[model samples]
Target: MRVVILFGSEMGTAETVADSVADALSAHDVSVYDMSDFAVDDLDVHDFHVIVCSTYGDGDLPTGAEPFFDELDACAPDLSGLRFAVFGLGDSIYGDTFNRGGEIAAEKLVARGAIQVGEHARHDASTEIRPKEMARDWAATLPVPALTSA
Candidate 1:
């Protein structure tokens, strides 16, 4: 299956976690990319999308994903045939806005016609929830069609 992994990070912790997730997916033959380096206009090319972005400041999407998010909001793609999942990294101490960035991204994707496969994952760095574990579990649950031998 064609899977895309997009992530945003500040101090690189989230990026490191995203890399691990990508490596795991690659072992399964899935393609992945860091949101900062991935082409946003090519979002329509993927069959499945996994978003792993971190919230910064007072609930803002990391610097790398802001432009893409804006484009998505402005020209909402018709993603009726696409399936997606989201994993958000944030600190619960932010109170009301904790993980709001990821929440917004997921909501916008749905609004633009993407089908969410399962529950959105919110991993709190300030809490007990581990982002890597959550990402691994989330990837394992994706409805990717079984690979067939040539």
Candidate 2:
């Protein structure tokens, strides 16, 4: 079983949370990618994907995430074989746009025919507790076949 943790962070919380998620997974193969370094072309290579992203200024995708989406749009790759899930980091003060970045990412993947494997997660930066721990717990609950031992 293999999994990929692809994250987009502005101030870096999402990356740290990615580490926690990787740590929590008992699977034998776990790969982590900073969105800045992730090649959108690689989407075809991984069948199981996890996205953790923070919404940036004015409810936008974080700096690291924009390129992937841009490339994905330009290429229009078929993603029906993929399975994915998302974790969103944002402050509720933004109201309707809160966590919009992750939502958009999820929407794009689904539109490309990827199967979503679990309930999506939205973490409020407003919360007193850090999102890392909660994110690990949330990711653990994904109905991902890759997370199970073969």
- TM-score quality measure for candidate 2: 0.93
Clashes per prediction?
Answer: 0, 0
TM-scores of all candidate predictions against the true structure: 0.84, 0.93
For candidate 1, give the lDDT of residue 94: 86
Q: Residue 140 of candidate 2: its Cα lDDT?
A: 78
Judge candidate 2 at residue 36 and give its lDDT.
85
- Lowest lDDT block of 10, candidate 2: 40-49
Give the CA lDDT, 0 to 100, for residue 43 in model 1. Answer: 79
The per-model lDDT (C-alpha) reads 0.74, 0.85
Give the CA lDDT, 0 to 100, for residue 147 in model 1.
28
lDDT of 2 by residue, 4-33 (tens): 889998999999988988887746478999
Model 2 regions more than 4 Å off: none
